[model samples]
Target: MGDYVLLAISCILVNNILLAQYLGCCPFLGTSKKMETAIGMGMAVIFVLVMAGAITWLLEAYLLKPFGLEYLRTIAFIIVIASLVQFVEMFLRKSIPALYKGLGIFLPLITTNCAVMGVCLININEEYTFVQSLVTSFSYATGFGLALVLFAGVRERVLLARVPKPLQDTSIGLVVAGMLALAFFAFKGMA
Candidate 1:
């Protein structure tokens, strides 16, 4: 239990997929413009990531390894992630139409987000047990949510502030994101 808790914390604040390794920057910068959209994307991503992690781990353990077809891990993982993304999309479109519309392309983009595949690969590579894989993936998604929401809040302020025309939008966003990444790294030692 303690190990799982520590792994979760590490994946979240310290080894964050966005702020730490710089994965999923597309959604981080794109969907993060609005707090509501960012939160929705975060939640959707969390669900997909956790599901993909578990499914991939099971596939790797039960089929790939047993059949000596480990080379197909990437393909298998992609299928699982894509399936989860489709499910999330349909569910959100049905239940939360507004947020679903707000998310737009960003939600589908989660299907290709390397972070989801990366965490699953990491779980298989590290040979994390079922519970550990789930916890780690959940934490990574939580970290993503944390960064997205916080960045959205800050970006709301950035939008209001007057700035030179050259750095009006994404240019300033990139700078702020870099700084946020650095700020997150400051906690590396604690984990």
Candidate 2:
């Protein structure tokens, strides 16, 4: 239990996929302009990452490994992740119309989101047990969520702040992201 807790914390803070590993920068930059959108995107990503991790782990252990299909890991994992995303999107549209609307375009965009795929790959490469893989996936998603929300807040403030003409939009966002990444580095020794 202690180790699980530590793994979650370390993954969330120390080895954050977005800030530390630099995965999924596209959505992190593109959808962070509005807090609402950022939250929606983050939640969508969390759902997909966790689900993708579980599915990929199962495939790797049961199907891929058994048939000596390790070489096809990337392609298989991607297919599963893409299919899972589609299923989730459809389910959300039917069962949670409000959330589906809230997520809007980001829902489909998650299929190509590198962070989700990255988590799946990490789980396979790390050879985490089933429970550990789930924990790590959730932790990674939490960290991604934290970063997205934080970036959204900062971007919101930036909208109101007086700034030079050149560094107003993406330039400022990039600088802010860099600083956030640096701040996250402080958690490296926590575990």
lDDT of each: 0.90, 0.89
The residue-by-residue lDDT of candidate 2 on 1-191, one tens digit each, is 99999899889999999999999998899889988878878888888888888889999999999999999998998899889889989888899898788777778878788999988888878889999999999999989999999999999998999989999888999999999998998887675
Off by over 4 Å in 1: none
- State every prediction's TM-score relative to the real structure: 0.96, 0.94
lDDT by residue (9-128, candidate 1, tens digit) is 899998999988878888888998999999998898898998888888889989999899988888888988888898999998999899889999988899888788888888988889
**Model 1, residue 79: what's the lDDT?**
86
In each prediction, how many residue pairs overlap at the backbone (N, C-alpha, C within less than 3 A)? 0, 0
Q: Of the candidates shown, which would achieve the greatest TM-score relative to the real structure?
A: 1
